[model samples]
Target: MSDITVTTEDGKTSVCSPYDTTFVSKAKTIGGRWNGPAKAWQFDARDENRVRDLLREVYGTDGSPTDDSDLVTVRVRLADHEVSYRDGADAKFAGRRIATRPGRDSDVRLAANVVLIAGKLPSTGGSMRYPQINAGDDVIVEVRDIPRATLSLEREGSYEIVGETRGEVDVDALLTEREQLLARLAEIDALLPEPEGTETTTQEAAKALGVSVRTVQRWAATGKVEARKNDQGRWIITITI
Candidate 1:
């Protein structure tokens, strides 16, 4: 490794490894020269225990430390590619399964779960070494940019390895399922009887129309639609549908 020195306008100096200093200076001085901020240092290791120790040092806890109970689970499917790492496990790139930590900056630490391929790799192994990925012999585990929300784990101050698995649902398939559900709900709504009176309170109209109470109120207020007042003095709106 080479060495380099950087000096500030005030003549403050800092020394770093050639690679490290070049990267840092490019980030600090060149601004957009490298596209975005400098890449974070990844803690890569084959030993699970060692990986956990490194995480504790960096994240300030052995497990997720946060007051919020909302957790996130991510399943990243890498393009068939390989990458080289300090350990043999990262030689042949393969897919990885990861559960998110509770606090912010969780996405930056996914390198802790990198896994390499063995002598006899999967059928998809050939694609893992593509130049676009440059993953080497391991499968590249691509992180999904969109984060997910998950139910809180029962254990406190610790995260459980939920096990990784192959075969994932496609985004299009999920959207199709949602559309079908909405259609079915619309059919069910059509089967219900209409509200008794022409004018009904937003709440009553929502129940009778099988829609959200807010939806009914919005129509009444914005559409300049009229509603009926009940004996209890509650304003009820009749849904056009």
Candidate 2:
């Protein structure tokens, strides 16, 4: 867990960091774009030095040393969604272009021959979601080495990698994790007995608070707000508003 990670792959360098407006502005100035699929800002390989300098200026250091030992390079052919790369007389390309009204059927396919020859195809044992692509923008793909546990922890609002819990670590990541833990703990701590607002069911409380019924249920379970289950198996929430 580091404030910033610099990864170089496929002739491109990707820099991942926690969200910061200042860092984002500087990253854009150096030809960096948010690669949604990779969850990182990407730059051309030639800008590696500039990227490092930018990281230093913004974060006081290049936060994490990237390990490319697990990475495999693969070529990706990119073209504008408006242009056709196939033969000029290919009717399918023309038909697709007409169907999209201006866009092309530019599917990002992995080179199967190269994958088989290199024998570097990643294992499919982990949970991987399909990537989302912008319909009209230029197709850009970046592959990074992120662990499966990292994704799982992210869902529960934790970002630390598995088994790296001790020693000198990124201050920012620690601070962020601490904040999240404190917030959840505060929610749970609210379970203490108090008598103030009128008692209502989860649905009534949700409507009064302008939140969803499920949110009220979660609040009851977490003590985020005050609530308890009555004998009838319904949540009895105490809401002032």
Best lDDT goes to which candidate? 2
Per-prediction TM-score, please? 0.22, 0.28
- In order, the Cα lDDT scores of the candidates are 0.34, 0.49
Least well predicted 10-residue stretch by lDDT in candidate 1 = 1-10
Candidate 2 per-residue lDDT, tens place, 1-241, comes to 2435776768798988655456789889989999999899999977877897876554445544221112222222122222332222111110111111112233323321211121222222111232212222232222223322223212232122222222343566557646755864685569755545889888878888899999889989999987778888888998763
Q: Enumerate clash totals for all models, in the order shown.
A: 23, 0
> How far does residue 227 in candidate 1 sit from its true spot (Å)?
10
- Give per-model CA RMSD: 20.0, 18.7
Query: How many clashing residue pairs, candidate 1?
Result: 23
- Give model 1's TM-score versus the native structure: 0.22
